[model samples]
Target: MPNIDATVTIPADATFDNTLQALRRSPLDFVSNLVQTHDDDIVRLPFGTQDIYLLNHPDFIRDVFVTKSSYFAKRKDISAEGSYLQQMSGVLPLFEGQLSTTYAPIMTEAAVNAHMRWDTMHQQRDFLKVDIYKEVMQITLDIVFKTLFKVDMQAKAADLVDAIITMDVGYGFDPIAALLNDLAPPVTVSMTSEAQAAHSYLLNFMLGLVEASRSAPLDSRSLFSWLLKQQVNGQPISDEQIADQALKIIFSMHEVTATTLSWVWYLLAEYPNVEAQLHTELTNILAGRTPTFEDLPYLPYTEMVLKEVRRLYPSVWIVGRFVRDNISFGRYLVPAGSIVVFSQYLMHRDHRYFVDPDQFDPLRWTQEAQAARPEFSYFPFSAGPRQCAGRDFAPTKDALVLATLAQHWQARLAPNQTLEPYPQKSFTPRYGIQMTLHRR
Candidate 1:
């Protein structure tokens, strides 16, 4: 641990500026290069006046999120507007009890319904050229919206897509933009007028859902109902608060689940051997039916593939946390109020933890293999109190979605398109994941 207290700064000059430009252009490549170039546990990046500490070492990351989790808090008011580009923590599910179980059937029906729609389209064209990004995002939106709110907004699905695109429109420049413009909001570009409009549309949509849930039966399973019924402090979560949080859930769930599923399809296309094993697991497990909660346990390989996909292309690449007072992790002391980041993308690929780090090998996710590693080394949904509230829901939902489609349809990458990961808030394919569908 050579001089852990000391730091290296990438200035606003040519070398560092070029990297910053690359970061804005291709964050996946930028940060990968940053980690490779720094080759140190902690790297200091200067974005105007704000100092960013990129903590790469697993132990250091553990200290930040778990071992000393209380020493850090989610950054408040990172952006002047727009839900921290849909990454803020307070606006999402607080993990009440057994949400995945309560929501499982809705999740299954949504996946099956998505397949039926594809099947209908496929009847007309032998091989449908579908954009996995769009389709998956739409399906997850349907799952979240319909399951929780008990309403269909299919007419506005296009608007939701627009919202996702525009909300994500300027994310890459957030770090630099925040600094230069004195916005100081990490990891988000300023909201565009278009994005603001879309945000308003979603808020209005969710507000309507909140109102509907107020009169909903006490036995209803809608998440909006759940939110309305619960009392925070002494009173129930407000309608405005409900609307704000509903939009946050809508933004986070649809984007993350959709992007992960899209990457799963892309990876399946690139690695046939892995795909074969996955299909075999589905075949032996489900035979020829849509997967549900019961079938998830037996479909271990399918879960492994999803795990591997998340490892390679995490839905959330990095999360921001404010350091609390004096903190000592190993030999380094991260001062309070400094912005520190721990990236799953970096740790998932760290050589010390993974062999053939870049390879998409699902077998590496075996129980024994997982048990051998440090707890924080592979936190795709994050860890500690701030860990994803949807942890149970996302995995089961992802496995079911993967199995539902992979069981009957084989989606291949469209030959002519450039299939590069877009490095968005989630790892989205830049050109969209265009695939030629084939019956399994």
Candidate 2:
């Protein structure tokens, strides 16, 4: 019946150029400062040249991601025309839901192998002191490669993750590099030569897989090979397109899932009581058996712990989308081409939706609590048509890994390892979460 006022914040006497310079200096700090002194859920930030809006409530999130998602497009600054870049992206056919079901055994085997590797590491040293990031990345890479390409990435794992880390969020969001990556691609080669090499290496690796798959039998299980059998509109997608999709699938599947599991281990280590409960659940439900996809239905606490971990530290801390058409929110008019940003980090911690929002209480996810919350309030993998292609796959993989690892070992924080969340494209530990593995 009436218009609601939106909270607006801007730098005193700010200019566009100065805003860009400020963000370049420290994205994390700029964001942290933006939220200070905020009393409302919707905060409008006119950051230099960007029309940034951070939607902190579930109602706004539903307007952006689900109810009116068609009016928005995933942000593409690196691929925008006038922004010194121009490109579009696509993914392989296996990215859909039905194909995800095909990777059940692949996901389970990777978890088993990680346990074996932990044993090997422990035997080599009195106690296994390891970075959770390194171990989880290896397991994710193994599963992605094994399921998608049927290749063993064991020896090449280091190089692959190294490149992925750099590309995903290692170098914070840089507008300078964004423009240069488009206009003068050679600048990255000169300024970040090692990164360029890793990027090239991964590119060549994908091209090789596609080339090799061309000669393989028609019924091969590899996704690249499987793509060769399909026709789109009575014709097959081009090899180049398939290669692009191959790389897309690998990047999406490996980086985000691995990062999330690393955080999960860190959270488990921090909350010993929670870990004990988890260990009990696995022991009672699994009874010394390996975790399988069918075991997914039987592991309720495992699911709750995962849901809680994601609530605290969503891999996709914040995501931005470009409004394609003007949209209206409560007393707000979001114009076409403006950037609408939302943080899962903020919404998940909102005291309105969560009780003791900062506390790690997996019990908060009991059926009663879950049903009481609004739908879009807890979307770690996002929601709507453009939601994560691997949404179903990640939890399956996480449960399998958590079940298998908790079954055989308990991880405790090793001394001198300080864990802090570093927000990037995906949130990551500033330094990897270090822990000592205790065999069960």
Candidate 3:
């Protein structure tokens, strides 16, 4: 393949330093601007001292993610060096299909629906709105514990949750130390020591859970028990591997769902009229009852609202893949071993697919409206075979939580406060969202 004219445009004002700074500070806004002014197919960004490529076009995204996934496995070169950041970097078998045959059934639509109502009932009884963030942490802990470990952490999971939250995502002290390590060799050893010290706290907690389960068979209802049955080429699963996969699934399921729901509440609080319409739909269909597996189809409007929020502020916003083989698309050819990224943040906001692009309109995602577009247009849960194994969980969880929460309580943003989306372990509120919950 010939090297096509680098048709990619670099903004005149977006210098290498400024571009990286922008990406670090606020990634969504940076990508949104590129989508507004530049073509969606490709844009080059310079981070620190390295050049990075950002791919936005759906066709290019499809080529990078679906049609060519084998050649582009998930790899994060930029953030993978730091131990504190590695917790957020590793991909589990769920995303890679290693656990598909073994683990998929537990997260089936019916199962997730059943789990969700239990969550909603508890949240309603607890008055979750005033303490929504903490409630999110508890729900994720319980869900992961019950689904994966077969044991309820119950009240004892607090220390474990605290440890998990302390894990970093590149920009914190770990990345800064890694940066120092690169700059000065003398201090590298100390930086590495500190990073390991921080990681040990979380690692030990996960290992302890694994050991406790072995001594006493909990419920045998979770992924942990399922792993106990698993054999790779005939060897039983080891404690180390179980710890990694368990920690992987536990954290993976927790933060993304937690932040997404936080943003859902933030969005609903931002728009009371949308909440009114959503409540109406839930009122008519659910009749002051909790949502079940059978009730979701009738709650299309509620689903649409959640989809719309996800489109605007997706939790897993930017996806990265390393190119293993040279692939050509249009005028550009990506060479083998090149790291490329496709931003859902940019593509979801592209004018070619969305009319206003920025407006939070749930109606735009109606079945008729969505069918009119290309298959790769919206990917909150990603696309193709490698998409999130837990995709079914989020929407089911959201529908149940949103619908049931609407029944007993109405909410709005506290005066003078608004949420700003930021990149964290996943897309998240830059500041904690504060809202006033009114009893309905």
TM-score of each: 0.83, 0.84, 0.75
Of the pair 1 and 3, which is ahead by lDDT? 1
Report the lDDT tens digits of candidate 1 across residue range 1-440: 46755444543452445655765666666667767876567766764445667788778877776788777766444343223424324324433343556567767777888788889999997579888888888778877776556687765776687677666663333633322223233454466677778778778878887777677664345566556765556787789898997786787677677878889898899999999998887888889887777887898898899899999999888777766576765566667667677678888998888999999999988999998887778888877766776777678778878888888888888877887765545677766878888887
Clashes of each: 1, 0, 3
**Candidate 3: lDDT of 347?**
74
Among the numbered candidates, top lDDT falls to 1
lDDT of 2 by residue, 326-374 (tens): 7777776666756777778767886778988989999989999989998
Clashing residue pairs in candidate 2, if any? none
Candidate with the larger lDDT of 1 and 2: 1
Could you give candidate 3's per-residue lDDT for residues 1-440 as a string of tens digits? 65574444556777766764565555667767776676546766544443456777778877766787666655334343233233322333323342233333333332244335445664677443343554456655665565445565755555665555545422143221221123211222232443465467666777887787788855444456665665666798788788877776776677677776777776777777888898888888978876665677888898899889888887677776656677766687666655576777777887889999988889988889999887787888876645676677667666666666667666566656555655644665545566656667
How well does model 3 score by local distance difference test?
A: 0.63
Residue pairs in steric clash, candidate 1?
Answer: 174-188
